[model samples]
Target: MQWRGRRQSSNVEDRRGGGGMFGGSGRMGGPMRIPVRGAGGGLGITGIIILLIAAWIFGINPLELLSGGGSLGGGGGQTQSRTVDTKASDEMTQFVSTVLAETEDTWNGIFQAEGQTYKEPRMVLFSRQVQSACGTASSASGPFYCPNDQRVYLDTTFFQQLDQQFGASGDFAQAYVIAHEVGHHVQNLTGILPRFNQMRQSMSPEEANRMSVRVELQADCFAGVWAHFTDQKGLLESGDVEEALNAATQIGDDTLQKRSQGYVVPDSFNHGTSAQRRTWFQRGVQNGRLSDCDTFNNPV
Candidate 1:
């Protein structure tokens, strides 16, 4: 992504290794689990050597593949986040910050050209748990933007999960995840999120989920908008856009449900189907016009 030595956004707050990430838990059935190794109990040295050899030979991730999946599972997960390796951690943080700075530049210029002020949203990096105006949440919720705080919260680990768990790998895919969450911030700036939240107050569960899907699709379009700016900057190589599109397709509510929970229900879909998600993102990319992102106006 040509991201080395790029300008890093000063808005990042690192909360890794902190304690008590859950101020209020139980959203989406507690913290989401990452695939990792289970206990390899009662294994002899020969067994261990054989396993390690198999891990290397078969391309298994020793972290989870041999032991079990990553965590035994974070419980009562009050912070105490794991510390990231300095070099590896800095690389991701820097990449995210640079991307954020780029978004600020893109949005600021676009807004100024229209005689408006663009508020650059802050991005927060945390671990297992973090508090927000919205409430306490685990990174299991993925990258989310809190409208009340006007900041985007990310657990860099989410990127690792994208490749290891979601089967969506690619720097651009990782970038798309960041861009999608930032898209929600953009929606907040446009008052789209709150309005929808308010409108959903009187809606039935089914209706609310439908509205949520529209909101998600709109965010996808916004990600496309970000891509549009990057495109102008010659930042994208061939298949870069495809990586993002594939990611969008891969993470749809339906797809995620099938992968994580198995099966799908149209009425329960809050993030639209894979096809719908990819389509809206493509709409934004192809048109590169904000007006083209009227996802609510169309019935998908």
Candidate 2:
């Protein structure tokens, strides 16, 4: 987590001011604010998750729900907006950029060793709400990588949610989140995403969710691969690895579901359990090889 004085990534797209024609991002070819209705006729957290995942894996827009002047009816039709103090966010922004740059360095080296070129993906920084090829998303939707857009969308506020809501702390935990998303970018670049999507299309919801768990666990392992490189370069300090493991444990689908719903539903888990996540991540850290990060072929 010793990121100070390190190089920052120029690939960061700052849409915090809501600049550009498409709400905030010039690269996204749509209006800033699009009306969306929550499923079950309620605008709840589940609604945001649906919007996010639809955009993330399927590249489909769920705005059709709003075509009938539908309502996010569970709560009052209120959009959550907060005036961000740019000055206060500068440090966190810098830290994220630095981690991104390091990830680029690590992946670039690994790819080169295999006679391949690594295509560095861009990261979009937004606040409150943002638009992408995936669709518009509220901060509530959390950080996601859209395979179609080849960019990672992050709302910095999620870092706060990680600490206050999930009980995951430390700068290394934040780096783990970014690294996990970048891991998805790696999967996309290597053509894993398209094949996975094709395979998911013919499966039942339960089976598809199981596939998603494998996908997420693989990303967690890839994050550990990046950590392996970071540690080799003496970037990791005391307690850094523990921070990331704590993060993986805290955000397990079973843990989150149990916390929110007061029950666990295994059939609906798209991400692996806490033990699975921690084990797969450790596998990557111990081997530091792409072959070892294959969560699909190997047992979780």
Question: Which model scores highest in lDDT?
Answer: 2
Residue 290's lDDT in candidate 2 = 68
The reply for model 1, stretches above 4 Å from the true place, is 19-89
lDDT by residue (31-99, candidate 2, tens digit) is: 111001110111224223323343345444445321212211112212233433334558988888889
RMSD of each: 18.1, 12.1
What would you estimate as the lDDT of candidate 2?
A: 0.69
Instruction: State the TM-score for model 2.
Output: 0.77
lDDT score for candidate 1 against the true structure:
0.66
Q: Write the per-residue lDDT of candidate 1 for residues 84-174, one digit (tens) a residue.
A: 3334566787788788877887777655665545667767788787776566877667777666666677888888877887777888887
